[model samples]
Target: MQEIVGYPLDNFSLNLRDIVDLIYFEGPLLTLFENEYGDSYLYYWCDVDEQCNRWLVFRVTRKTLRFYVTQKLSLRELIVNPVDGFLYSIELDDELQCQRCCLIQPPNLPPKYIPAVDSYYDFSKLDPEETEAKGLLLEKIWDEKHELSDLLTKLFDKPPLEMIDEPSLA
Candidate 1:
């Protein structure tokens, strides 16, 4: 027998920092989100999946990312969908230096169920530049550190992965 590994991560490499960043983004998501409620005294990292889609959420506030997704909603569907309904996005505006979040429903879901969810990123504790830099550095490292894109493609055909629901995953 050969050395046993937890999972076949041969396709890519993941560092501790990467894990931390992901936790900082997705902790709230895993747990039921109350948006404006709860205390965010802690920070963490979340491990996504084979495709490596990472996300970050806060306890004190709510922030969503439109472009930053690990594996999309398809993967989540395979596991579960406990959301109240539909989906939304949490995005940030660097030029203005602020944080905001919003949740809406999918086109297939009733438009009445979704709201106009939008806001800037929360950077009250750390400088926007500092926070942004750290996340960006991690992102850059992950993006170029390894051929993750190609690896994911190899694992799941481009079509199946692309068709996956995203909001459900986050």
Candidate 2:
């Protein structure tokens, strides 16, 4: 099997507890979902756009803390999360006690593991031909997102605020 190589960073430690603390302590906690067992999950996106894009997803359970980096590998694949997701699972000795935290890294990892570097795609920087192609792709993406939002709104019986141009106030 070929090794997955990424960009190296000085502060690219994969300590689960440390990562969780860092995310919480840094600020602006964006919780994606929570379970019935009082366990909350967070999906920290790398970019402003949120369309099944790359993200750092984690869940804090009563006895365990898990996290992973999800990236879109291929457009042809139908998988939700990336197959090469760098995952980590940490088990707490006691409830909410991180003193005896045990981290479990996935097996068969490359000897030289590197951190992923963030990339910014500026549409304005592209040439005319490239811009047209990229613009079309982006338009399709936004269209699909809009359609999904509308479907969900109808499914949940919620008001279609996004679809409406000017909401009526009465």
Candidate 3:
């Protein structure tokens, strides 16, 4: 299956050490996160470069999963408007060190809705030195990943595969 553009990746070529060097989260925090949130469909990954400009986020709830990519700007607030109405943002300094990280949860939304993404480009094709590696077209990526086709089908309200399949004609 094709990969989703701007979606947090479960499987990637980069190792945890390489990935950790790029993002703010440490082993302890990551472990705590898994405990707080169930591990099924967990999304996590970052750009494999010195300046880790982005991160993929995902939270799987008892009911559903939410995903999006949060941006990291130089000396700027990490989160502007959260899609899930809640977030955990880590701001990095110019030296690629964490300045501050915070968990922003509004009273209006429940605890379940969380946030996650990867870039739109194919990592292998992009130049290591080039920063504007916003690779593939969004529409093409979306369609290729089956995101547009399977999103609605993935909603928890839909019946399970066993029920959907036709009974064999004996």
Ranked by TM-score from best down, the candidates are 2, 3, 1
Q: Indicate the residue-level lDDT of 41 in model 1.
A: 14
lDDT of each: 0.28, 0.31, 0.29
lDDT of 2 at 108: 32
RMSD of 1: 20.7
Best of the two (1, 2) by TM-score:
2
Give the alpha carbon lDDT tens digit for every residue of 1-170 in model 2: 22323333333233232212212224322223444543444433332222222233344332221112112222112112223343322222223222211222334333222133332222232233443443332332333566545533543456456656686797
Local error of candidate 2 at residue 35 (angstroms): 19
- In candidate 1, position 96 carries an lDDT of 19
Q: TM-score each candidate.
A: 0.20, 0.25, 0.23
In candidate 3, how many Å is residue 106 off? Answer: 4.9
After superposition, candidate 1 runs with Cα above 4 Å error: 1-20, 23-75, 78-82, 95-102, 107-170
- Candidates ranked by lDDT, best first? 2, 3, 1
Q: For residues 26-110, write the lDDT of model 1, one tens digit per residue.
A: 2232322221323221121122333332222222211122122323222233112323342322222333111322333333323
The number of the candidate with the highest lDDT is: 2
What's model 3's overall lDDT?
A: 0.29
**Candidate 2, residue 98: how far the Cα is off, in Å:** 2.2
